[model samples]
Target: MKLAVIGLGMASKPHLAALKLLADQIEVVGLYSRSESRRAAMAAETGWPAFDSLQAVANSDAQVVIVITPPNARAELVQTLGAAGKAILMEKPVERDLARAKALVETCEGFGVPLGIVLQHRYRAGAEALADLMASGRAGKVLMARVSLPWWRDQGYYDTPGRGTLDMDGGGVLITQAIHVLDLMLSLAGPVAEVMALTGKTPLHQMETEDFAAAGLRFENGAVGSVVATTAAYPGGAETLELECTHVALKLEAGALTLHWRNGQTETVGEVTGTGGGGDPMDFPCDWHRDLITDFAARVQAGQAPRVSGRDALRVHRLIDAIERSARTRAIAQVEAEA
Candidate 1:
């Protein structure tokens, strides 16, 4: 498929790498961003041609357009892409909040274009195994789940204007960093029905949004779970999710999965891989991104549904919204009904 990328920033590194690896499946014909300097850097660095203007990108022959801009700057860009009849693969959180996210999704739908989101954590080998088991009903009903994102980000990381602020990147920990794992968790365990949360900022980072969030989740399937996501941990550790099912118990940490069966036998699948949960946000490999892009390109050609479509991504966004609501009201908050 012919493809192009917009908003060539720090977040575009893995994507650029992924596009290179996926050269056979996707031809990255052009790159664009508001800053000519950034476009120059990307063109010089990756040898991908730079589009001089948004109109140039819209007028191009690229079938798939990857929009990797910050959360605060997406609506108008997506609108333009939609009008240009370009299928979009956007970076996560869709927008600053759920309402904006929904409108963005509608904009793409109005163009009758497929919109995919880059929640690549769901493409990990371990996550795939667990997801297959869940769909197969071999693991039985998940009775309980435990999720933790003990991530760290030095104050300097958030020192950039609009880094941790509500106005720019949305929320601090949950929306920006933890959203990957949160999306992975929801994809594995299904939708959350309700959440009671306590969220606030620790002194470690002077930010506008919460750096720490702890919540109790009640899944629509009658499964229960706990979530502790934060960036306050020093030198962050690997994020983890544990699911205790009727047939067996599974633990997925980093990129590996361990199954503890009823017969006292245990087996592990996948090798441990860097999660980028620590200091360096781009520390992880680009393999997962490659896999996700591979699927997306195939689906785009086949005229099929995306593995992580924009509307489907709303599951995690709704869960995050409920968490913040409960954090504020100190009461149980229900996940919003999906359309």
Candidate 2:
């Protein structure tokens, strides 16, 4: 399979690196970026042809296009690709807004193109194993879940123009950093039925969106959940998801998983790594991205939906939308029912 890449920003490096790992399955045939300097730099570095426009990318022989642009700037490019019948694999959170995300999904569906979201955490070894355990009833029913994303971003990080803004990066902690954990929570505990949340800008950073967020969740499966996310935690900390099930308690800290069963047995699965916590957001391993990209290539070739399809990712967005609504109203907000 031949592929093209758009947006040469922070996420571009990781995606490109992962694509390189999958060179046996897919080849990057073209590249695009609004910034001529970035395109030139990438071309000079990789010797790949950089297209001048989205139309050029769509017109290329590349069968799939990887979109690593900001959440707010994806609709137009994705619509163009979908209309051209090119398969698309986009970065996480789909879009800055739920409506536009939905519209993008519809456009892809209408064009009969497969759309995948870059929720690569779902492909992590620990997460996949935990999800399988939950599905197999080996862990019994999940009673509750706790997610903590104690990430830190200095004032200078948000001071960058378009950073942490609703127009560009979308919402703060919840939508940006915590969406991965939130998506994993949904995968393990099922859909959130309702949410009540509160958000505010922390003293550590000056930004239009919240630097800290806490939410109460009621999952459709009767499992309760709590989410605490912040970029204000000094020096930051590991992002963890603790699921208390009837038979066992599972804690996924960073990329590793630990299981504590009712029989007083404890076992750890997978490896622990930095995962960009307390560091630059883009600083993390590309293994999971490689897995997801590999899956995307296979799905594209098979004419099937990718593991993390657009519709699969919209659930996370809907939960975030509900959390935002709850924060605004200071009341419980029902999650939007999916069609």
Candidate 3:
């Protein structure tokens, strides 16, 4: 499958490396970036054609287009490719604003195009195994879930122009940093029914977005959850994500899977650390990206619906949107009907 990955950000490097593993199956035909120097550098490194325009990239031999641009430009880019009749794999948050997110979904629907959001956390081994446990009734019942993260980002991180801006990066902690785990939270429990959140800028960071965030979420399955994510935590080592259910507790330090459950009626569950990547949430199954791309390509080949279609991405975006709205109004917001 020929693919084009638009945007040369931090996440793009892994995708490029992953494609190297499946060199026989996938070929990156095009690369797109705004930074002339970085774009030239990426092209020189990959030995791929560099295009000054996204439309040219869309029209190239790349049957699959991966939009890794900022959330603000994602919708327009997706819509553009959809117009060109291309299958798309986009980075998270769908769009910078809810209206644009909804518009992208609607446009894709009208065009009958295939879209996949890069919520790669859903592709993690730990998340998949735990989801299986919960679904198989081995976890008894989900009584509660807690998604917490105290990740660190240096002051230099937000120094970039669009680093923490609402118009470009979307929301700060939850939308940008914690969204993968949060999406995994929703994927584990169920779609969020409502969310009441508080977000603000506590530290004098280099940007205007919030540095601290906390939220209370209610899952539609009657499971209650709490979320706390911040960049203000000092001496940041590893961010933590713990999900507790009726009789099971699954914890991931960074992204590795760990499970603790009641052995007997009152017995304590044993301790063991799971394999797979634990630091970068983006590093999951080696073939996860390939699986995602192949799935989209297969759908495009068969003229069928994609597993992570644009509508699916819109649902994730809705949760992100509701989180931001919930923060502003300091009230719970509902997830809208899927289009």
Q: What TM-score, computed on C-alpha atoms, does each candidate reach?
A: 0.98, 0.98, 0.87
Rank by lDDT (best first): 1, 2, 3
Stretches of model 3 off by over 4 angstroms after superposition:
264-291, 302-304, 337-339
What's every prediction's RMSD, in angstroms?
A: 0.9, 1.0, 3.6
Candidate 2 stretches greater than 4 Å from native: none
Ranking by TM-score: 1, 2, 3
Model 1 accuracy (lDDT, Cα): 0.91
- Quote the lDDT for 94 in model 1: 89
User: In model 3, what is the error at residue 230, expressed in angstroms?
Assistant: 1.0
* Residue 171, candidate 3: C-alpha displacement in angstroms: 1.7
Best by TM-score: 1
Compared with the true structure, what per-residue lDDT tens digits does model 3 show for residues 1-339? 788888998767667776777678777887898887888999999887788888788778787888888887776677688888878888777776678777877787777777778776665555566667778987776778787666666676777678878888876877787777777776667787888888888654667888788888887888888888777665344555677777767776654667776664422222233212223434334455666666666777787877666666666677777878888887778866555
lDDT of each: 0.91, 0.89, 0.72
Instruction: Give the residue spans of candidate 1 off by over 4 A.
Output: none
lDDT top scorer: 1
